[model samples]
Target: MNTNYHYMRFLVSPKTADALSLRQAIQNALVQTFGIVGGSIYLDILWVAEDGNEMVLRTTKEDSTKIVAAVTSASTPRISLQKESSFLPALGSTSVTLDEEDL
Candidate 1:
């Protein structure tokens, strides 16, 4: 199976911007356009980095075509994306039992 990922990194000046709106735009695009199924925003960890900028999002593997089309035309205009490699390990080598309660 092919696993795809997308990452968007933005550089913003703190005093000259509203980070909330930017995040909203991205989140809206993810839901309305790309059809992202699940994730979380670490807002408390948002901050200016070593370059005196801030970071907001990190999404798991998603459809590349959808992701690109969604954010490319967003209002924020500052977000940029990068694709990364992800690895998954097999959980078990045998069939596992599932009880009625498990379901």
Candidate 2:
């Protein structure tokens, strides 16, 4: 079965240089905004800049809104929502970047 996903691009403040830091920031945001349960949501990091304020990620269609809320409402490691795509099917794709808009 094909899984539907929402691709999101976020601009992280205080810039992160690595994926681990970025992931932590997002997780913190989730937990802070929605408590421990929110932290359980899986965030798939699709691509990240080697060192910058940008990164692209994916989440299940059902959790897309929750992710947005966490990003917009979180007080720690402040993040700005940049762009998001309508739910797209994740087929046999190898990778995708924020630069490409094919999805």
Candidate 3:
């Protein structure tokens, strides 16, 4: 199969507590949003910000929309998908600064 991978830039809630928890929350959210198979196949974290408030995710191009929907729909420690890019550098270049209110 020809897989077209894309990167999703996202801002995570600062109240997420810790990196491990945030990661778990993301995975749980993915599973909750897309179900077992789709979430397992599509949701993968490529990079995480130093502060753990931002991240770059990799997913199939076809599943990009669903990934975004999943992240945005998450309730606790809200995750928001900022943009999608085919290039990794492009995803990395755009910096998102978060404030207390933004989280």
Q: In model 2, how many backbone clashes occur? A: 0
Candidate 2 at residue 1, lDDT? 43
The whole-model lDDT of each prediction reads 0.45, 0.74, 0.74
**Colliding pairs, model 3:** none
- lDDT winner between 1 and 3, please give it: 3
Identify the leading candidate in terms of TM-score.
Answer: 2
**How many steric overlaps does candidate 1 have?**
0
lDDT of 1: 0.45
lDDT (tens digit, per residue) of candidate 1 on 1-103: 6544333444443322455655665567657764556312322213324543544344444543454566565655444443223332221123589999999
Q: How would you encode candidate 3's per-residue C-alpha lDDT over 12-46 as one tens digit per residue?
A: 87644356676687678779987888677645777
What ordering of candidates by TM-score runs from best to worst? Answer: 2, 3, 1
Q: Compose the digit string of candidate 2's lDDT tens values, residues 11-31.
A: 777777678877887788778
Candidate 2 lands at a TM-score of 0.72
Q: Give candidate 1 misplaced runs (Cα > 4 Å).
A: 1-8, 11-19, 31-56, 63-66, 82-103
